[model samples]
Target: MDKCFYRRGKVSLSGTIVAVGIFMLIAVRGMGQTGNNSVYRLTIAEAIEFSKSQNKWVQTANMEVNAADEDRKDVIRAKLPIVNVNGSYQRFSGLTLFTDGLSHATTGERKPTPNSAALGIDALFNIYGGGRQHALEEEQHLRVNLARLNAQDQSGNIALQTATQYLNLVKLNDLEKFLADQLNRARFRLNNINALYRNQKVTRSDVLRAEVNLSNVELSLEQNENDIAIANQHLDVLLNVPDSVIIIPADSAGMTKPEVSSLLQLTQSAEVSSYTVQKAATSVDVQTAKLRSIRSANLPNVSFYAAYGLNYPNYLFFPPVNQAYSVGFVGLKAQYGISSLYHNKSKIAAGKIRVKEAAMQREAYADNVRLDVRSHYVKYVEALRRIEVNEHSVEQAEVNYRIINNKYLNQLALLTDLLDADNLYQESRFNLIKAQTDALSIYYHIRYASGNL
Candidate 1:
C-alpha cells in the first residue's frame, strides 16, 4: 500500500513538472513554440547542487581562495634562495682607463684601455633580515586562513538562500492548492444558486453574486500562477540556469520549526568559528606580524651572496684577457638603516594602531553576534507561534466553510456568507503555509548563525 501511494505521488509530481516545464519553454522561446519541447525538471537538492557548481558567487569565491593560496605560496618563496644570471658589456668609442692598484703597473704610465665587460650568475640566500621574511610569511599564513573562512562563509550564505527560495516555491504550491479548493467550493455554490434561480426559489441577484464570487476565485488563481512564475524565474537566476527551466521542489510540510531557543548557545559556538570572526582574528595576527616587521626594520639584514660569471669586453661575448673563465665568491652582506629614526617611525606607529583597531573590532563583532542571535531567536519563536495559530485557524475556517456551504446548498445561507467563509478558509491555509516556511527558514538561519552551516 505504501508503495502504491508513493507511486501515485510520483505520478502527480511528474504531471506538475510537465506543466511547469511547458510554461518555462514558452517563456524562454518567446511564445513562438507551440509546446513541442521535452520537459526537464530539478528537485530542490538538485537545484542547490547546480547552483554550487554554476552560480557566479560560488565560482568567484573559489577564485578568491585560489588567489590567496597562490599569494601565500609566493610570500613563502620569497624566503627561499634566489638565483639570477648576470651579464654586462661595455664599449668605449673614445677611451677607457685602467690603473694599477699600487699606484703604477709595468711601465708606470696611467694609460687608457679600450673597453671592459663582466658577466656572472649570482645567488643570494637570506641568513637573517630582522625577521622580515618570517613576519611576511606569518602574515600570509593568516591571510590563507582568512581566505578559507571567507569561502566557507560564502558557501553557507548560498545554502541559506537556496533553502529560502526552495521553501518559497513549496509555499507557493501549497497556496495554489488552497486557492484551487476554494475555487471548487465557489463553483459548487454557483451551481446551487443557478439551480435555485431556475426554480424561482432565489433571486437573480443571488445567482449573480455567486458568479461574481467564482470569477474572483478564478482571478486569484491566475494571479497566484503569475507569482509562482516570477518566483521560479528568480530561483533560476540564482542557480545560473535559464529562466525558463522548471524546478520541482519536494514536499516540505513534514519539516518542523527550527529550535531557536538555544540560539544564544549556538551563536556563541558559531562566533568562535565564524568567518567574520576568523577574518578579524587573522587581521590581528597580520597586524602583529606587521609590527614585528616594523620593529625589525632597525636590525641589520644579513645575507650570503655568491657569484660566478663570464665577462666579455666590448660586446665580444668574451673577456678580452680571458675566455670561458668562471669565478665564485661567497661573502656575508649586512645592511643597517640609521635613518630609520624618522623613516620607519610612521610605519611602526601605523602597525600598532592597526593591531589595536583589530582588537577593538573583534570585541565589537562578538557583541554584535550575540545581539543577532537574540534577534533571530525572537523571530524564530514568533514564526513558530504563527504556525501553531494558523494551523488551528485553518482547521476552524475549513469547518466553517463546510457548514456555510451546506446551508447555502439547502437554501438556508446567503451566497455572500458562503463566499466569505471560503475566502477565510483559503487565506488561513495560505498563512499556515507561510508560517511553516518561515519557521523552518528561521531554524536553519539559527543553525547557520551558530556555526553549524
Candidate 2:
C-alpha cells in the first residue's frame, strides 16, 4: 500500500509539471494571437510581402529602374530641336550696333548708331546624324529594359530569401513543440523510475539514468529555444519589423507542387520569362546600338538650321541708324569629320567585337537558365520522395517506441532499450519535420529558377 501510495504521489507531481508546461504554451500562443506589441503571429505570405516592400536590395533595384526611366526620358528629349533666345542693348562708344566695328573705321562717325535693342529666337534641328541619334535613343530604351529586368530579378531573389527564412522559423517552432512533448514524456518516465526505486524493483543506477535522460531533454529544449530566438530575430531583420516584436509563425501550408508543363515547354518559357536571359539579350541590343552609333562617325551629318536674332542697330542699310530690329532666317547645314573616316577603323572594329561578345553572353545565360531549371526540378522530385520515406519512418518509430515502453513497464525490456527507442522516435519525428519543410523549400527553388517567384 505504501509503494502504491508513493507511485500515486509521484504521478501527481509529474502531472502538475506537465500541466504547467501546457499552460505556459497556451499563454504564449494567446499572447501571440492578441496582436500585442511583444508578440505577433506571422504568416508566410505576409512576411514575404512585407519583406519585398522593406528589403533594402529590392528597394534599391526599383530605385535604379526609376533612374533608368529618367535617363530614357532625357534621351528622348534629344529629338527636340536646340533652341535659344537672345536680347542685347548697347550705347555709343560701346557701339549700339557694331557691323564687325567696320562702320566706325569707314564712316568717321562717333558711333554707328546711338542706343538700340533687339531680341529674337534661334533654332537648329538635326535632319540626319547618320543614324547616331536613332542609335542613341535605342540604346537608352534598351538600358531601361535592362534595368527593369534587373529589378525583377532582385525582387524575386529577396522574396525567395524571405520565404526561406519564414519556412525555417516555422520549422524551429515545430521543433520547439516537439521538444516540449519530449520533455513531458521524459518527466513521466523519470517519475515512474523513482516509483520503481521505492519498491526496490530497479537499481539506483536506473534512477540516475532516468534523471540524466530528463536533464538531456530539458537541455535539448533550451537549445531549441535559443535557435528559435535567433531565427526570429533574423526574420525580424528581413521584414524590417521592430526588434522587440516576437514573431510566432503560423501553421505551415502544405506544399502544392506547381503544375509544370513539359520540359520542352518549360525551356521555351524560360527563354522569354527568365530575367537573366532577358537582361543578357538586352545587353546584346545595347551593344548593337552602340555599334551603330560608332559607325555614324564615318558618315556625314545634316541638320536644319533656323535662326531669327536681331542686331542692336540697322546695319544692313548703307547709313546705319539706331533701331530695335527683327530678323528671321532659316537654312540647312551639313558637316563631315574627314579625319574620322580614317581614324574610326579601330573603333568600329572594336564595336563589332563587343557586339559579338554580347551575343555570346546572351547565349551563355540562356544555356545556364535551362540547366538551372533542370537541376531544381530534379531536386524537387527528390524532396517529394524524401517526404514519403520520412513519414513512413516516423510512423514505424512511434509504434516501436510504444511497444518498448510497454515492455519496460512490464519488466520485460531493459531501460536502455526503452531509452534507445525514445531517441529513435524523436529522431524520426525531427527528420520528418525537416523533410516536409525542405520539400516546400525545394518547390520554391524551382519557382525561383523558372523566374516565376
> Taking the candidates one at a time, how many backbone clashes does each contain?
2, 0
Steric clash pairs (candidate 2): none
Worst 10 residues of 2 by lDDT: 1-10
lDDT of 2 by residue, 144-238 (tens): 88987787787677767877888888788888888898899999999998898899888999999989999999998999899888888888787
Candidate 1: what lDDT? 0.71
Top model by TM-score, which number?
2
Model 2, stretches more than 4 Å misplaced? 1-32, 35-38, 89-110, 113-118, 253-268, 317-324
lDDT of 2: 0.76
